[model samples]
Target chain A: MAESMTETEQRPSGVPYPGTPEGRRGTGDPGFAPHDGQEAPELLERSRALVDPAMRAAVESLPASMRRIARYHFGWEHVDGSPAAGHAGKAIRPALVLAAAAALGGPAARAAAVPAAAAVELVHNFTLLHDDVMDRDPTRRHRPTAWTVFGDADAILAGDAIQALALRLLAEDPHPAAAPAAARLADCVMELCAGQHTDTDLEHRAPEEVTLDEVLAMAEAKTGALLGCACALGALYAGAGPEEVAALDGFGRQAGLAFQLIDDVIGIWGEPLRTGKPAGADLAARKKSLPVVAALVSGTPAAAELAALYGKPYITGDSEGIARTALAVERAGGRDWAQTEAADRMARAMQELARAIPDPEAAGGLLALAEFVTRRSS
Target chain B: MAESMTETEQRPSGVPYPGTPEGRRGTGDPGFAPHDGQEAPELLERSRALVDPAMRAAVESLPASMRRIARYHFGWEHVDGSPAAGHAGKAIRPALVLAAAAALGGPAARAAAVPAAAAVELVHNFTLLHDDVMDRDPTRRHRPTAWTVFGDADAILAGDAIQALALRLLAEDPHPAAAPAAARLADCVMELCAGQHTDTDLEHRAPEEVTLDEVLAMAEAKTGALLGCACALGALYAGAGPEEVAALDGFGRQAGLAFQLIDDVIGIWGEPLRTGKPAGADLAARKKSLPVVAALVSGTPAAAELAALYGKPYITGDSEGIARTALAVERAGGRDWAQTEAADRMARAMQELARAIPDPEAAGGLLALAEFVTRRSS
Candidate 1:
């Protein structure tokens, strides 16, 4: 492990360590360590190669209608069953699975974790399909949402099928870790649903009636649980002991929170061309995102103004009002607060990763991925 | 096994055997064997005692918001979280689990199957919650549907949580059968979803476009798969070999088909007070139920008239049109076909049960339960 420490020292000089104070500033750039921008993509590509085939096979095993909907959702086909060169998701969770497995048990562990990686990806897509329907979002990945193309019932059933497929993939695996991994994944899904329930419930409440703590908890449950599950599953597949697995889980959880915090910030200020959504879409929908909740509770004059804007019954096509609310959130210190909180979470994630792997070289891809998640404009 | 066979011979004479020709008529009575009506109630009561608490515990394990929705859906509480005597569904799936275990491995097996029983019940309720929302039905079990009471998002999330809980219960079980049982249950859910997808898809097409074969296949997937899973899980927990487990699955599948066939008949003709919905509810919605599909393909004058009736845009609260359509369906031989098909399925179920248990007495309760399911007015 000590021999690998030199790898961290060799990182490019301009990129601040994610834990450093300079990295805590609202710098737009991720400034990833060393050759991460180049190296991480190759790693992710390799992980995707391992995971995508397995995922395709799983989806193929579904019944015909469900298979069609899943294929369409994954950008593998069109609504009319014609082949399409559509863009799939970034496969971030699968990359994490493989990286975590490699960190724990090296090359063989990475190989063994492929099924787990596929399972996690399937779960991620399942959530996306269902979430898109529940949120009534019209677009994802610069294309029409599955519910819009395939119809809501088909989309919902397809999501259900994919969830079952995830568990089936793990359960059918010959690995000794499969059963436990399935259990963990199921638990994570329950937490995800609970978080979603709270999220939509909060939408019905007055802005001031919601608390930052509640929103934070919801984010952890909704976003962090699955990421933690992916890491834990990878570690489990690597035959790591419970303590190491748990540490990796903690690492992923904090990293997930950091990712959500940054994502929330982007939801408010992201450029539409990059994010594939309208600018300030979250504000337009009056979504009680982390930053929005934080701003509402800030006790500043801007916060009061933001609350008053939220108090008005939302009218359709009120883009200007939504834009003003975004400005109010920023003026109330929500943007800065989210940035600082994300950096702190990244630091905590790094601490947990160090405790788990104890080798910075093995942890390189994980650190890069964490930076990538937080840094992306979309 | 031989001693048990004698118990079957001692059944009273007035109650017809489920396999008898007289039981195949549209008498609207179960014609249960011996003291089945009375004895079955006792068995169901005992099974419920074992399954309900476990189900409650599973629901309670969910987060507070989800727990509230689940409890309310199960009729254990009101919308305000106050206690209420609500009617949960007939714990038929759980009872099948316990009964199958008992038939296969006797008393100890029955006790060992408790977790499997609970898991199946949870899955059943999960499907019910989701199906209710998808169907947009306003009432279930003589009360407003969960979606009406808790909102669509909450109901959907609660349903999702229950499904996860079901898998969790099995995965966490110490029994050797737990992993396989969980896998089987997940597969059953996938099939159920596929069937639901097909059902909704068929609804979008002209009634004549749907074939009897397709309707039967959907019923088998939607209803039979879960029942089969329940029996297979029970047998698995009893440590039965694959052959016996498969036989029990066949038995349950056939019985489930019979139940569905009868249910389709009831949807057309059953009393509103007993069924807890308006009379001819399926007809009113222009639902492509099994009998209706069968009639559409019958090619009689009545079939054409029924098609014309279905072609019209359905108006809400048009009970007279629904009643006329129901009569047309009967005139086209749908009623007769369903009755014969149900009897055939019941016979097939009995044959499979005999192959598995090898003792008539061991099958008595199973036969009775099958009869009860097919005979119920509700």
Candidate 2:
């Protein structure tokens, strides 16, 4: 059993801390010690050490300038070229990949860890780069956007390069499911493009023109598809049965949608300083976020006034007005509605995992992961 | 032997005729023929039969608006959906793909024909779409550009969709080398992107600021890489030996470069009515064409006057002055220099093919193919 665990359990080194509650901060120790709540930390630490270099090597294969951008975006560098190594993200997406593979009966999941980790990270960063361009905002994770640093053309290329790298890394994996995983990843990428197209189109529309269902559809295609891909690829590496893959896909889809809902909520109501953003940032931009859409549909007096305000071009000092509108959404049950939906999604994800995993002990970390994503501040 | 022939021989297309001999008048047929010196009408008919539908399928994979613009650009439809097919292009690129595969050796080549043919055709169209955008040109072949009909965003997306479809089609091939070929195709795509970046960058630089070597490097990356991908992919599908693959890569690269040089010549000196373009188009745009570069280097009085003329910003009637400049290039032996270089490249390409392929009969068609590309009009 010990030998089997050595072969089957691991996380990438940049993952910081795996399976430990203390390391959940977006920043902390670069040294990760993966644990199973009861398992020895040394065993998990060794696994992470083996995977980290591989992840870096895969990322380094990209074009030099793009690699530099990715390195910075991943929080490995400060703007001034110093080694900051701030919060490098949760690594939850890749963890899902490795855990799903293990839950499925494949021992090859350990070998897949580096690529699995790198691919998800790349996908996340690709979105960030493009979203920054589309949103026309300057900073990300407390640093200048790649577009801001390298110019829009180079930033576009950087995103393109990272997307290509993700596909290439997955292709290079020796797992039997590499081909299918690649096709799925490509499909996910296309979905991202489509979802973004719709989002851009929506930006020009009136507030009342947007709907909750449309927001959900956009969220699924833009965010959920990639998360689903991560889980499906993990299952693929594990040689999971088709049923298991399907269940995990469902789980990931729900979890991703829920994640987006939480993000939307935070975008409107989270504390500015803690979020490293201005209050009511999405509202100030007149973004058709989930809660805003919900409020529009509710037909309250506040909704009517908000619609009137959104009809005009917002000027300076209008952010406070948008925050007042967000408050109306809270009063109108939009926040409550969003939170309920997230809880329902979390329940669905857990239920699917229960059905697919067979071994409940392996799933504890995933359950914690789901909670972490839904409730975390940053 | 019958089966082997079936594998290795492309039924010759009738005759190659594109537009008209006069270049200005529009002709329904692009002067397509069966094969060189072979008046097999069935071969021409079969080649068309194989290429047209596959090209349609490839274009249909794009988004609807993109498909509409692409169809109009291909001369398959008017902006309002009126019938308009004959003047689009000769589909020569796809024909070359099939011919190269058949000229190698394998029954599998026949199975690979549609996809390999489609791949090259899509790539060619992709370049045309982006070239139209980057060059800010209004027409291609003999009709309005896709961007003229569908807007820049749609045109860009159409080009992107074509690239994706080309790679996807190649990936679906069942040959053992298909995976490696797909990888090569992806690498070529990155090169194409890099070349476009370089071209866009050069747009802001003065003619004196652009170096000859930079022009050559950009040409190789943008044009030669895709052409090489087409040839190498065809050879791989045909189950050709490693030597043949390497030979095809060189053949494609050289042929592509030579083709570009002739294109530069035509862009400056060809009759506008015949070429469906303004005479001295490149010069009018103050483009850093080979002849222009030669004129810059020749140190003649006429060359200096031409440089002065090129130094001024171009307006509508500047094409006449550009033509006079092109005449200066001919007097300086630049046109002759370029033609001789083309011939040299063709000879070198043939030499590589000869060393790689021992079958004289099979080698004959490939060499003829090179001649057709180097000397092609319109």
Candidate 1, DockQ score (0 to 1): 0.63
Model 2 - which docking category? incorrect
The first chain of model 2 has a TM-score of 0.82
Residue B263 in candidate 1 has what lDDT? 76
lDDT of 2 at B166: 62
Local distance difference test, each candidate: 0.80, 0.63
Give the per-residue lDDT digits (tens) of candidate 2, residues B1-378: 123222111211122211122211232322322234322333334556887787788667654545676687778888898888564565655655665676785435845666777767776776677667666788677677887876655565555555555655654555565566656666665666566667666666776677767776777777777777777777877887778888888878877777777667767776455456556777777777765676666667766776677788778876566667777777766666566555555556655655555453454445556555554444
lDDT (Cα) of model 1: 0.80
TM-score between model 2 and native: 0.81
For the second chain, the TM-scores of the candidates in order are 0.90, 0.82
Residues A215-250, candidate 2: write the lDDT tens digits. Answer: 888888777777777777777777777887887887
Where model 2 places Cα greater than 4 Å from the true spot, the runs are A1-92, A105-107, A123-137, A149-151, A171-174, A376-378, B1-48, B51-92, B120-163, B170-173, B298-306, B331-333, B376-378
- The worst-scoring run of ten residues by lDDT in candidate 1 chain B lies at B4-13
What is each candidate's DockQ, to 2 decimals? 0.63, 0.20
